[model samples]
Target: MTMKDPKSYDLLSYIVVFLGFYEGVLPFVAKSTDWEPFLSLPRHLSSPAWWIVSGLVIVASFFSLWGIDIAKKRRHPDA
Candidate 1:
């Protein structure tokens, strides 16, 4: 079977990583500072829905990175 070019999706994978990182870290930053605009965000951060969605996005990003790595290795076995 032929494999799709992994390079084509590198940008997408990186974007997911960024988003996951942002989602996971934003709440912590919001809570630790007195940033006026983020005051309300800290409240929602305590909800179960917030944790679930953040966890899902972070997990998805991890899997996406792993898949890309496997694809690249399969495309270049000797490397």
Candidate 2:
């Protein structure tokens, strides 16, 4: 397989990580603390749709980080 640019993966991973944090972690914290969320989101945290979307974002972030690791390994097998 043609190796992808690790920098691209790095950038994508960072973005996904931020999204995961924003969607998954931030909402619960904001709701508990009575602080306004940074992004406008569904007010009902108990909604199944909200949980599903947040879970997907968190999973995607994990995969993105994993992709970066795999790309780095492909670039430097000896390291």
Scored by TM-score, the top model is 2
- Looking at model 2, which ten-residue stretch has the lowest summed lDDT? 38-47
Question: What TM-score, to 2 decimals, does candidate 1 have?
Answer: 0.58
Clashing pairs in 1: none
* Least well predicted 10-residue stretch by lDDT in candidate 1: 34-43
Displacement of the residue 13 alpha carbon in candidate 1, Å: 3.4
Q: List candidate 2 segments past 4 Å from native.
A: 1-8, 40-46, 76-79
Q: lDDT per residue, candidate 1, 1-79, as tens digits?
A: 2345555556656776777677655554554684433433332655676666666766877888898777777876654
TM-score of each: 0.58, 0.62
The C-alpha lDDT values of all candidates are 0.62, 0.68
- What is the Cα-based lDDT of residue 75 in candidate 2? 82
Q: Give the clash count for each candidate.
A: 0, 0
**True-structure lDDT of candidate 2:** 0.68
- Please give the TM-score that candidate 2 achieves against the real structure: 0.62
Total backbone clashes of candidate 2, pairs 3 or more residues apart or in separate chains: 0
Highest lDDT scorer = 2
